[model samples]
Target chain A: MMAVVTVAIAVQGNLFAVVVLGSIYSFLMATALVALDAVDVAMTEASVGAGISTVLLLGALHLVRGEEQKPRGRPWLPLAASVVMAGVLVYGTFGLPGFSDAGAPIHQHVVPRYLNDAVRETGVPNVVTAVLASYRGYDTLGETTVVFTAGAGVIALLRRRRRDRRDGDVR
Target chain B: MRNYLVLRVVAKIMIPFMLLYALYVQFHGDYGPGGGFQAGVIIAAAIIFYAIVFGLATARRVVPDWLVETCLAAGVLIYAGVGLVGILLGGNFLDYFVLDRDPVAGQHRGIFWVEAGVCVTVAGVMLKIFYMFAGRRREDDDA
Candidate 1:
């Protein structure tokens, strides 16, 4: 947490800072996932979040310069809003389960069986895969659809407007 | 032009080995930390390397836009098609027990096919994005 805060502070005034911070946060989250025994999720986060997202963002940065255009609006409203959000989130966390509480409802749920028997049933050593592909396969299917949708969106966005106009002109 | 020669030679040497490793990882995921996603990225990275080295026109010639689109569709179709097969065989959706007489073997079969589909889709998407970005960069460079 302290390291994340320091990194965030270091990147406070840069556009690429957000990307760096996000990548760091992702890697940290991947570590957290590993601690939680979700190795597959951790792997995905490490690869997709830390690796791919950073590279994609860098590519985008190459196209669009990373320097911030000077702020043209009053900062108070946004600052106050963010503060309120932070406060509410912090307050909400007070009532939430403490980390690593063995007696927590989450620990007592059906997930324990998933953690234990996933390998035996799915024949996959990665419990995350067993759960993702077997237990919640429908959700995974939906995720695939979302990815397809994003791909379609990119194609649509990147389609040559001039090409369309040219086709119309020919017609 | 000077850098191109080096990139082309390195890519030529590396791509085949990288793709071979991807296939290996995809097939060996049942026993290791590798899977469809890893294989997909590795393969896509190789293609991106090829495009960067040999030029987008050449890369696209090797793997045309239509092929990428088809791969994207085919992956999803394969996944859904398998589930539909299960349904047709009188089981719940994706219930692999109906895929074969033995339930365990059926699960393996289901996972293998689905992972393959995932690999295809992911690789296509990655290459698609790389092409988009690289094409954009080329346009910018030209201008």
Candidate 2:
């Protein structure tokens, strides 16, 4: 079903349908995340990917025509490049431990400590939150800063538009 | 959109709940399958839904551009300030254990503020991006 949606999105000429299909694709991916027990990620995917992004994409679509752009050159080179990249990635995953292996290197490193001592140390029942907001505080701080930068960048780009439009660079 | 009576009425009903759920996800994150990022996106989506059902102008009035920008900067500050406070309390930057007499209590305090910062920043960015894109005149309109 995911594959079918991808193909539908790929072959669809109407940009509006493509955008809607993309939302469906995100919804499907969210479900897949849930199946993997990544409920946090699933929630983010549902809200960010399938929800707000669909609205954002529609806003972008409003700026352009309903149809896909005409191809100006052969697409085989990019297709071949993508295929090669996919193969190499698949090949690279071969050395990973079998699914849920108890002795996997990742399990050995920090998993036990976080599981055994997180509540005792941080008093937060949710290890995920404890890790995100405390143990990995710096990383979350950085992420927040990145989000701030992005918002600042967008404002710099768009907020002064009406005044700048008379300069003839944009319509 | 305004004339679509069913759409307007349903969205009017749903928007408040959507905002409420976003808040729920924000505070209930530590106990549930959610956090600031998800909650913030949910919040932005609720507003964007209003922008779609109503009009961009009306939506902007409800969430003015200035307020969104303030939230954007303030969230980063709140996160960083928590780290600085940790350092000032005789621990390394972002060391939550030093935040209170009880390290566990400190951890709770640190996580709460950090998540709040993240939620505010995420909500601001999402809304700002949506507004920027939606506010642009459609390319075909003038053509």
Weakest ten-residue segment in model 1 chain A by summed lDDT: A2-11
Q: Cα miss at A75, model 1 (Å)?
A: 2.4
Candidate 2, residues B2-104, lDDT tens digits: the string is 7899999999999999999989998988878788888888888898899888988899999999999899998999999999999999999998889899998
Candidate 1 per-residue C-alpha lDDT over B36-57 given as tens digits, one digit per residue, 9 for 90 to 100: 7777777877776677677789
Worst 10 residues of 2 chain A by lDDT: A162-171
Q: Is the docking of candidate 1 incorrect, acceptable, medium or high quality?
A: acceptable
TM-scores for every predicted model: 0.83, 0.95
lDDT of 2 by residue, A142-168 (tens): 889998998899888886764577566
Model 2 spans with C-alpha error above 4 angstroms: A167-171, B138-143
Tens digits of per-residue lDDT, candidate 1, A103-138, equal 889889888999888776767776655565667767
Chain A (alone) TM-scores for all candidate structures: 0.78, 0.94
Residue pairs with backbone atoms closer than 3 Å in model 2 (clashes): none
Which candidate achieves the best DockQ against the true structure?
A: 2
lDDT of model 1 at position A132: 58
As for candidate 2, its interface RMSD to one decimal place is 0.9
